[model samples]
Target: MSLRQRPLQASNSTSRTTSEPPGQPTNPTQPNCHPSTPPRKGIRLNRILGRIVPIILLIYIAFAYDLVVVRYAHRHLYLQRRRTLLPIVWLLPAHGLFLWSLRAYLRVFFAHSPQYTNKSSGLISWLRTNFGAAFPDPDEAQQLEQQRLNTLATSLSNTEVKIELCQADGQPLRCWRDNCRARLKAFRMRHCGDCGTCRVGFDHHCAWFDNDVTAPATLRAFVAFLASIPPLYVIAFGPLFPSAWHTLKQIKDFTASDAVIRSKWYNKWYSWIGGPAFRWIVGYALRASRWPKPSKDRWPHESPRTPVLVALGAVFVFVATALAASSLTQLRRAMLTVDLERAKAYGKLRLQMEKLEKLTNGSDVEKLTAIRQKMETLSPTQYFKVSTKDKNSGEEKESIVALSPEEGLLSRGSAWANIGRFLGLKQASSSDGPAWLLSEPALRKILQAAALLPRENSN
Candidate 1:
């Protein structure tokens, strides 16, 4: 009996020990046992914030502009001043700027091309057609693709954009199979995951525009849209303070008038709905109201608009001016917002590469190759010429460097030249076109003859 009891006790103890290890979870089968709750909550919070912030900003801007400019400023301007035939001239360039800005904003916010539409005829059928379309005749497909690319290049060149292939030591370097196919299909094109569409020279997916802002065609419109806001605000509210002051005086005088209290319409309405409750409600509203009290002091040129409205208008003007200045700087540098973002990423990668190189004494070919591969992935189109020195021999060795376009690896020409190209004064050209096609320099001279009018002139 003792031997049997001892064996049973030993077996039970061994089973208990095997089932539960030290400092381990008692119930591993439970789904909530793992500590993954905080990360998921954080992700959800971020997603919510990302959407809410943009909506809040847009709503605030709309409300501010409506109150300060349209409702208050315009009304005061018309009330105080007599109407004139050339009232359009009052907002120097703002009315015109507003129109152009609105046009460009519409272009960016809405579809500039039919390809941006999501209304598919048949999703399954379209997928089936495209899936097997490449199978029938590979050579024929390639040739047709080449022609399409050439046509696209010609169109861009006519618009005054300078697109070129990656050159190594003054010679055009060939790309890998996938990149070569991409080049043939659409030069420097990228598919946007957020937009779920392929855009040429894909810059970035803009949540504000709810679209992808890309190169060649839409870039000018985007810049114009940014450039238009400041002037539009100036034209709309340049005389806001004066008009608001006049409106305040008018309101004060009207409210204080014996005629307003004793008017037949007011007397009839007061009699129809007279009570202590109504009087109390009216008293509360008067106290709660933000409207300014009547002032005894008068200025030479007092505006009829509200002081609050004038302050808001001024704030909007300052904000627009700041945004305009930054946008103009980006234009002069020929740098897209996306480009600036990419530059930051490229700089980070360079720092990492330098650290890795130092760790391996700059001789770890495999690590160097991995870093280079990442750099290439970020900016597939731009190229750089880099030099590194040998630690032992101090000899300099040159290699073709691949950096993201955000890093500005390519030439932006002069500020005026870039502006010219952006304004369509210069033509878009690409070296990715067929070898038989005319070179960029030669085409530039010829295409400049048919330059479009500058943006300001058209407006």
Candidate 2:
């Protein structure tokens, strides 16, 4: 059972004893043992900043331009009437296009459902017909996970792959339950606790998207969606002031007279809903009541909307630029955020193992065992079958090969090859079926690295 399914027991069920192993702290709250939840307040604030702030900025840009700039400028500013139409000319098409894109993106994001391994499941069948299905029910996901784990276990000997296991605190080497990795010729679908499903090429579960973004089937769409948004922001905000200025003249002429405005029959309803806010703000502004006293009007003696809109646009550009840069980097690397992080973790784990080897006596069995235990905790180890044919008999025999993160260089490949994999290309051979594979060059390098590992193990 996963940690989520594990039932909570009485506090006294696991008793603490003073006679614990030396050099090993008995505290379960150690940094490496259990990760802590971030402060709730900070998390809430970040969510507001990331999601709500952009919305607020967008709303502010609209109101600041219309209410403050256009409305007031027509009455006071000395700019030509044609120049006053700039903001309207610029914002209309750009904003309209962005809204349309956002609508389409939302449709894709929330509507797209993932395909699970179990084709027999009713949910999967339904999803095949209706790609808009958001996600599988929790019970269904749990069932699918059980089936996946069962299948993975049956393919491996003893439901686990055994390797040399050791820990820094003098733990002996042994075959560990949690250390077993996938040895089958299947997609390495990682079970995400947060997403509550096994996602192929699993990436980070983005709270912004509120979905499990993977790199297999959905990667191209995901990247394309990401690549589209930043440009929209650029178009909208990059020429924020210029658009406002270009359309200034038209806005000035339209508002030059106090002529009563009437909306088209189709847009009457929309105007009815939105017109009240405009009326209220205008009435309040003209009354000199200054409901929001010491407002932008009190300072600068010039068009306050100019600076305010510029500031809003600048903030938007900064955020969009960062996201664009990050998405581009991920695209170029051809790895999901989670996959990249896992690769980095592998490098760190290998470094730690090397350091341990350098510090310990080469001939000490106990020390070596301790090192193996540490290795087991860092990542899973799997036993794969490598077939060889005897030349004389023309008979094939299979030998089991144990591989771990350090020795198994499957996901990390040349950028181009990784990109091919990300784009849903399969490199299946008739003999191997659909096994996870590394580039030939990467495989050769990994074999060379694996060859050196035994020397350290012997030492």
Candidate 3:
């Protein structure tokens, strides 16, 4: 039998009904018709808190130690040494370099676009539809779904065509022979409208950067985090190196003499310059500065004169910056390579050539050849003349529903929200509504796909 003669099989048996199409609207008299709710601000806040609280606590502790403990010790020492003009030469540039590096980090993070969210969503929707399961199983169900998709594809390709005449610019034009011809043309493809998810790369939806953390923006943010290391290390260690060294050695506690405290403060002078030039000067000063004496030194002349701690800190900063720059460059190169590969692959599938081949049936091959010649005369971009309206009714309709603010902010779109909004939250404030009330796990799974959080790191 011809492929077109085969009966169309239902994509799913349980979820669909014989009376209505999949995802079709139901009668108002139907019981258990619950509408979904809009996502609550409280749920969003909880998710944000879950991810942020631990990091915030760590930062708070670190800040408290620096402000309360470190600063207090310095004050008690009454370090009243004259500001040395020699160190200022090195400090200014070092400070500038650190700031410049930080700015570069922020720039990279913000430059990343959220284009990948749509792609990921499309992939997910394709899997869900083709598999014929809300969640795929490894057994017989998965195999059945795959078979159905293959059958559907083959049937679509083999369907017989009939010619019809249409008036265009007062001239007769040939068009397709199908019942839903207008809808098929409107969507550009027949099956796409029936598919559950939006087509990836074909359609772009607004994406929340936080939802797709692996998106360019998130990756850029990660890169920025990495780039921040050198400057942060330098700022933390440059002036504080001597004090750190003293603390580590159990030599004079931060409760030291005024001269020693002033010396420690002056040692970090390179931090003021804030750039590479400042770094060079700071390195030089650290190598030249005298080391502080130990309280229990049996022999005064035996103490080391070199500022070893300061020299080491400068070396660490330079090495860190070099590594971060190299890594960022490599990552950018890899992403560009992948994009080029995808473009090359897409270019090979010429839809116009496929259309021409479809027209060449029986002995009318020469007629089809002439049509192909005419098609080739047009520019590649102009080859596919997509009409804005259905030829019969001349009414233009959107293929995909545009997302609204509430629906656009989360999930694939408003489909999930219908259920959430239907369930009114009388017990809690709108802001405190729990995510669990709106299928928390499924929402989280979608958000995770969007990359709002770090991916599971196996290593």
Candidate 4:
């Protein structure tokens, strides 16, 4: 039998029915099948409350005990007379450093940069459509999809292919190819029909600026990424360290006089400053106070100051290294523009384009147009252009130009460069060339340097 002439199955086999035994009545109000409910706003609210309430309560209790119990006991026993404000002094800077490190860590983990935003939203949506629908078990599917996407993205860096093209005049076109090196180092790539070249590290297509994000904007983005560390560290570590140390010590031995004194200080400090004080101030104060004074009597007990200073120094060094590496990479990318321009001056750029045209099949015009339209909306300038264009126009003419190697290279670097400028960093220039500029690896490295990745299974 022909495929179209295959037998049809009974609809009743798949369909639900309300038939029942004698005396039973079907409930008309009930849904045909229980519809899956979207997670409610209250569920998110409860999650937030659950996480926040305990931290808040613990902080509150610490402060209360220090004020009502520790202070009263110290005053009653005249132990407050020998106390020097020196502990507070050390506590302040120490606390500040701890908080700074914490802030840096959290920022690395939770802070969203445009680069991160693009990757996450794209990945999440892709996973949702691909895996979410294909698998029967939604939760299991999501996990599998996430793992698959990450693996695919990592693996794609090594794949290389040569694209062949032909000229419009029926001349045999040459092949255009990029090696594994380029693919591995690329932040992203964009195909621009008008320019007839593939740009690398393309940040975003900006129609409003009439330019893509290049040079300065990319630098700015890096700066912004770096800047976020200080604040995030403060938020994560400022209260957490001091509160944690005091709490831990309290657990081990409640009778230590030093613990009692530190406890008193924490209570007053929390009340006076917890509500609105800047994170830096709180951190500084915490660092200055000596809870358990340096004791040479025990082999395992190292000087508290040494560990605190070492940690702070390590963090600072990592941040510095990341900043330097990112800056150098951007410089190298800028230099590529000059190289490309020189290649174009020698007619190589045109040759490469001709080659690309020869090797590939006719343009996937519909796919290209759709991709361009999607990209245009991402930028302000493109948004305006889209708004101005008539919706009914099925075909919009695109200007095609042969770019000099420099122009081609610049086009590739422009996206990240623009992001840097947006974040207030110096623009990439033609004189400097580095491999690290605006690449995803560089971004990931910066995050790692900032200690953004979880050290343990926080969840």
Per lDDT, the best of the predicted structures is: 1
- Candidate 4, residues 1-459: lDDT per residue as tens digits? 000100111111111212222124424332211233232233333345545644653464355334322432233223544544643553456456545543433332232223333455676545433322110122232243334334423433432211111111111121122211111112223322222223333333222112233333233333343554455444333433443455444433433444544466444656456455454344334544544553443212122332343345347447646754555454445432223333334354344444545665436555444433332222111000000111255222211111122323233346566334323343433423322233333222222222332223438
Model 1: per-residue Cα lDDT over 1-459, one tens digit each = 000000000111100101222225335443212332111122333344546745764675576556544544354344444444334456546556666766675565554334313354575445433321111122343454445434534544333222222232212222222112222222234444444334444555655455556654555566666666666666665655456666655655554564534343334556447576675345323432533443435432343334544555566567656755665576566655555666667578789999988898889988887666555444324332222333455444333333333433332456764454433343433322321122233233222322311112424
Write the residue-wise lDDT of candidate 2 on 1-459 in tens digits.
Answer: 011111111112111212332345435542223332322232433344446644664586576546443453443332333455665665567667666655544533453444342443576455444443243333343344345333433433322211111222212222111221221112234545443344444555554445555655445445555555556656554644554454443334444432333222212455445477665344323332212333443322133345446555566556656765675477455445665555566567677667767776456666666544444433433333222333455444322334444553454545555555664456622322212233333333322333311123334
Worst 10 residues of 2 by lDDT: 1-10
lDDT, model 4, position 459: 80
Candidate 1 worst ten-residue window by lDDT: 1-10
What's each prediction's TM-score? 0.48, 0.45, 0.26, 0.25
Output the lDDT of residue 320, model 1.
54
- Cα lDDT computed for each candidate against the true fold: 0.43, 0.42, 0.32, 0.33
Top candidate on TM-score is 1
| Position 379, candidate 3: lDDT | 13
**Clashes in each model (backbone N, CA, C under 3 Å)?**
19, 25, 38, 73
**Candidate 2 versus the native: TM-score?**
0.45
Output the better candidate (1/3) by lDDT.
1
lDDT of 3 by residue, 1-459 (tens): 000111111112111112222235534432212232222233444345535643553464355334322342232222223334433544456456556644543333232223333354565444423321121111232243334333423423432211111111111121122222221121101111211121211111112112222222223333454566566555544555555454434333322433544465435665567776676455334433444544543222122222333444466457557755654443333222122333344343345456656765434667555444433222111001111223465443211111111322122224323222212223321442321121232223322332222445659
Model 1 has an lDDT value of: 0.43
Candidate 2 vs 4: which has more lDDT:
2
The per-prediction CA RMSD against the true structure, in angstroms, equals 20.7, 15.2, 22.6, 24.9
